[model samples]
Target: MTTRIDDTALLIARALIAALFVAGAVQKAVDPGAAQGLLAGLGLPQVLVWPALVFNALAALALLIGVAVRPVAFALAGYCAATSFFHLIPSDPWQMSIFVKNWAIAGGCLALAVAGAGRYVVTRQRKL
Candidate 1:
């Protein structure tokens, strides 16, 4: 049995999920050295940080606005899974935990993609 409050719950969940990217973007903007170094360490171009930062910010806004939830959720799920590779460090429990967390976040995004944004979306799309 679902109530109107279920939509509210979805809204809150979307906001919370989006907040993860928001925080990451802000952290990168404030101190991009870490992200840049991470990229460099992985034999990737450090300049990728700019695009990643932009993507995170845009995705955060899209999620907050409840726009293109399915697409955004799917994209974020992939992003989460890809980034988890950086945290694959069994020697460091913290990094391993972060890796697990990233996978967990990806799972949440997958759920959102499957379930959709519900009635709290800012722009409603025609349901097929």
Candidate 2:
């Protein structure tokens, strides 16, 4: 059984992760052209722009609803890893900070992916 503190931590982590995805998706969706430019600048194919936006939006929804949490977390983690590699490999001061932040968030996503969310997640409750 999980303790209250554990539950609280999970909730906070979930919300923060969800918020990050939601914000990213919203930003991309709002300006897909910009997102495409970013992807192209990163040397990624322009075709990834729409898919990335859609994936982030869907992942955010999954996290918000605590549905398919592990898969969503895994997907987001992969995305973050790729993004970090693309943006941070150049080693600029700004990109370094973003890289650190992405890695931290990816760590949280990895925890959620492996641990299967937590006591407060819908998946946990649904199991009962």
Candidate 3:
């Protein structure tokens, strides 16, 4: 069915988006000092680094496993937008590219939130 195929496609897209965050979380966990330094440079407190790492990991897992998709996607969208403005801007070409990429990712998250993980999600919220 066309709907079934579309749902599968959405599942794949969710997984791919989650993968990027998971990989980034792994990198941050592996080299937390670097993450801390970067966060500190952004004028964030050092204590917040670990929480951010944990949030990233949890959000990525939720996205990948198709649980609470809409809220998780929305939250990640906010994160992406916030980071793009706070951390990625006012930098070199590489960071500019990342800024643009974050916005694009945020846009995808917004779309996913609206789409509600299609039919591939663990649980579906029904209309009242």
Model 2 TM-score relative to the real fold: 0.83
**Candidate 1 global TM-score:** 0.92
Order of models, best TM-score first: 1, 3, 2
Query: For residues 1-128, could you state the per-residue lDDT of candidate 1 as single tens digits?
Result: 44679888888989999999999999999999999988988999999999999999999899899899999999999999999998898999999999999999999999989878878777656899
- Model 3 scores worst on lDDT over the 10 consecutive residues at 83-92
List model 2 lDDT by residue over 1-128, tens digit each.
77788877777788889899888889887877877876788777888877887888888888876788888899889889878765665658887888888888898899988866576655443555
- Could you say which candidate leads in lDDT? 1
Q: What C-alpha lDDT do the candidate models reach, one value each?
A: 0.92, 0.80, 0.84
- The regions of model 1 sitting more than 4 angstroms off are 124-128
Winner on lDDT (2 vs 3): 3
lDDT of 3 by residue, 24-108 (tens): 7898788888767767888888777678788889998898878999999999999899878645656588778888999999999
CA error at residue 7 for candidate 1, angstroms: 0.7
Residue-level lDDT for 100 in candidate 1: 100
Better of 1 and 2 by lDDT: 1
TM-score of 3: 0.86
User: In candidate 1, how many Å is residue 59 off?
Assistant: 0.7
